[model samples]
Target: MTQMTRALMTAIGATLDLGCDAIPSPGPGEVLIRVAVCGVCHSDVHIVDGDWGAPPMMPLIPGHEVVGEVIGLGAGVTAPAIGTTVGVAWNGGACGHCRACLEGEETICAQSEGTGYSRPGGYADHIVARAAFVVVLPRDIDAARFAPVLCAGVTTYRGLKRAALKPGAHVAIIGCGGLGQMAVQYCRAMGFRPIAVDLDPGKLELATRLGAVATVQADETDVPQKLRDIAGEAGLRAAVVVAPAPSAFTQAIAAISPGGAVIFIALPAKTRDYLPISISDMANHEKRLIGSNVGTRVDLLEAVELALTAGILADIETLPLQNANEALDRLRQGRVPGRLVLTMA
Candidate 1:
């Protein structure tokens, strides 16, 4: 067995610690990947900082947006032959027989396992992932550029799909950070006009460069009015809130068209998770607040296809794997405008 270097979270609210360990062989229905790059997600910061519950295990390796090459396959696995490039996402694995799985909605599987959470993740030099869960990626693209697509890309794509909007409709991408920027590009690729909302002018500018039709500053008064004005008579068909702020949710629910949906993907800290919504307005207006988890395997496939054909890619900054702690710090500080990817090479 080859020794692999990994970053480990010893406890909640602790900076990750670097360590060396032997790479384990894949078991049945698994594949061993030589990890090339892994995106540093804000959720990693949330997990490390205990914004969510305790990690399923201590000394957790926090990464899910992983891209790598398959170097070995477990027994009974042969399709994704050795040397194939693959990407692992937030969805690590799920029970095959659950009702959600049968309904082709494995993202909602009650017994779903999360990468970098319930199992060993991609913050290491190597990873062993469930064979059925890894998406085979194009060998042409730089692995670093594809890392965030495994999470942020699929996430926002699925969110938009849930909106059920028509082409030329307006969609608000709240936050305008890494995920929000991707949301903007996806909206354009999916044929909907994207309206970017954020407090940071820099991010809003970047969103425009990435194809946002309009930009709104979140801190301005009458933000909903501004959104309505920009969206015109059609109004915003949906708002994808990728920001972890409860205020963003409040604003999104208020800004979208009366019958429009507000898709929630961000997970704030447990203490700040509660939101007060008017049940009467929701009922009368038929507004919907929908929760989109990471995404299904099919959603990932579509996202990858859109990225390849429509030229949608993340704005990424790369760092050496040893600098994992620094990457997490930047994400935690909200200092990164786009995704930060940690490279093992």
Candidate 2:
């Protein structure tokens, strides 16, 4: 086996060099994985453009939705076999002793290490990951197809799970992008009446194909009123805002019926500290607004299983790792019709 691993490095703004190499060795409780497919996420753009918190060590490797096979295990790592297929998600590892980790919410751990942002992520041909943070993939699913579930699918899945909706409840999904598409499928599988809202008619059409019961184009006048009409008649239970538009939150708040919850899953390019909804509205209507980040390890596993069971696979355009820059450009320009994934040979 070759000792050197080839990786794509973001040397600076929008520039990637393909010659970077790393010889990674797993430490105690960690493993080295030979990456098969790494799903490109919107978060990568934030990291590359320095829009997110801070750049992860300059010349960073960014890719978190990774599906690979364990090639070597570090000392004290006993769960995954050498050839076991696993996924490395956004949450690379967390300090198990933290209060959040202790409560089974390690995704919010203060010391949690993010896969691409905080550490060397999956853009490389191989990566070192904490064994505990990896989820073993099922043998029945194609590895490439399962890649996006690690982040996008799991994020939407966790949002719905947190919503705590009962069967037959009206659930609205705003934005039919990668995450919103997954949300529609999961909501349908969970027996919720899935309603999709988006400005793009193509995306709405895709959402319908993915099992959404209704579609609302944001360009329509009185869109929120239409959502409210639907929710009021059907008894709205919750809404998940997968769209990053700050204005969408206000529309979601208006559409949700009394006691309905709205979960914001997207991180906008810029932060808006406050929503347009007044405190009185929340209190009087008994409405709840919550924010969810990428999911936990357990959520990743469940997301994979749900995707496999419901055939809720992501519609992706696969590109070679060499074309990563092109893929990122397309994603940044909003030209990508679906998720873009990078494949490694």
Model 1, span 218-241: residue lDDT tens: 899988889989999998889999
Residues 294-327 of candidate 2: C-alpha lDDT, one tens digit per residue: 8888888888778878887888889888877887
Global lDDT scores for all candidate models: 0.91, 0.84
Question: What are the models' TM-scores?
Answer: 0.98, 0.95
After superposition, candidate 2 runs with Cα above 4 Å error: 3-12, 271-273
Best by lDDT: 1
lDDT (Cα) of model 1: 0.91
Error of 1 at 268 (Å): 1.5
Clashing pairs in 2: none
